[model samples]
Target: MKIFSENITVPASAIDENSHVNNITYLKWCIDVAEKHWLSTAPKQFQESHFWVVLEHTISYKNPSFEGEELRVETWVTLAEGVKSERSYKITRISDNKVLVNAKTVWCYVELESQRPARITEEIRALFL
Candidate 1:
């Protein structure tokens, strides 16, 4: 499977009271990378016609990361069918290659104007494949 990846440096703003990257920050990163991949790979017409909404998210925190750490976030679409698909992510600390987080999110496809559930088209699936 082809994976889309981005590297991000942990900033002070992302840290929480626990002194590590906050849970919410991880979620934000996941969505950001996913959206980026979709926008960069999908056709313009498809992009303007469809949007996605998170239906579910399952994340595991395996390690803690500190400020100034460079993190590599990699994501890929695992399933695409009907009105929904699944995307998975692995966030690793760049220096040590420690897997800090593993996550999967279920997203529902929707029409941009109607905001109603839309079926995934063959062309859209091909873009990811």
Candidate 2:
């Protein structure tokens, strides 16, 4: 699978009372990167037929990130099963290469109109794999 990586700069607004990036913000970063990765691989028809929904997420915070620090967020598909898939993320201090956070999320394919589970296509699977 292809892992998508993007650089992010910590902004003053992202800081919390403790003067570090908020824990929830890290999860948002993970979600954003995962969406970007999906868009890159999915076709326009896929967007019209279905949407992916997060079923579960597990996040681990290993270190703190401060404002003005440069970070890299990476995401990839770890597994694809029947109508569900697992995505993994890593946030790291770019210069030092220290992983600040890691997350794994389970997502389900859903038919947009019915809002029910739907099977994924081989074309979609190939794009992700």
Candidate 3:
């Protein structure tokens, strides 16, 4: 599986009372980056055949991500099985390369009309390739 890596800055608004990035904000960033990467790299593929919806998410925070910190988020497709696919993310500090977060998410292919889990068609596989 290919890994996609991207960088982002920690915004002041993303900080929490603990003076670091809020837990939910980290999860949101993971989702945002995955969607952005898919849209930018395969817009037609994404629109035509299928969509991946999040089924479950597991996140572990290793270090505090403070305001003004630069972050590196790396996403990788682990596997696609049945109607579900798995992706993993590693969030690191850009300045020192310290890992700040580790996250895993399961996505299910859903038929738009029936709103049911659907198989990932060949077309969808080709897009992710």
Cα error, residue 105 of model 1, in Å, equals: 0.4
Candidates 1 and 2 compared: the better one by lDDT is 1
- The segments of candidate 1 whose C-alpha lies over 4 angstroms from its true place after superposition are none
Which residue pairs overlap in candidate 3's backbone? Answer: none
lDDT per residue (tens digit) for residues 1-129 in model 1: 879999999999999999999999998999999999999998999889889999999999999998999999999999999999999999999999999999999999999999999999998888785
* Weakest ten-residue segment in model 2 by summed lDDT: 120-129
TM-score rank order:
1, 2, 3
The local distance difference test score of model 1 is 0.95
Instruction: Assess the local accuracy of residue 32 in candidate 3 as a C-alpha lDDT between 0 and 100.
Output: 86
Candidate 3 deviation (Cα RMSD): 1.7
lDDT of each: 0.95, 0.92, 0.84
When sorted by lDDT, best at the front, the candidate numbers are: 1, 2, 3
Tell me each candidate's TM-score. 0.97, 0.96, 0.89
What stretches of model 2 exceed 4 Å from their correct place? none
lDDT of 3 by residue, 13-81 (tens): 999998989999999989988887677666584456667799999999999989999999988777777
After TM-score superposition, what is the CA distance of residue 82 in candidate 1 from its true location, in Å? 0.5
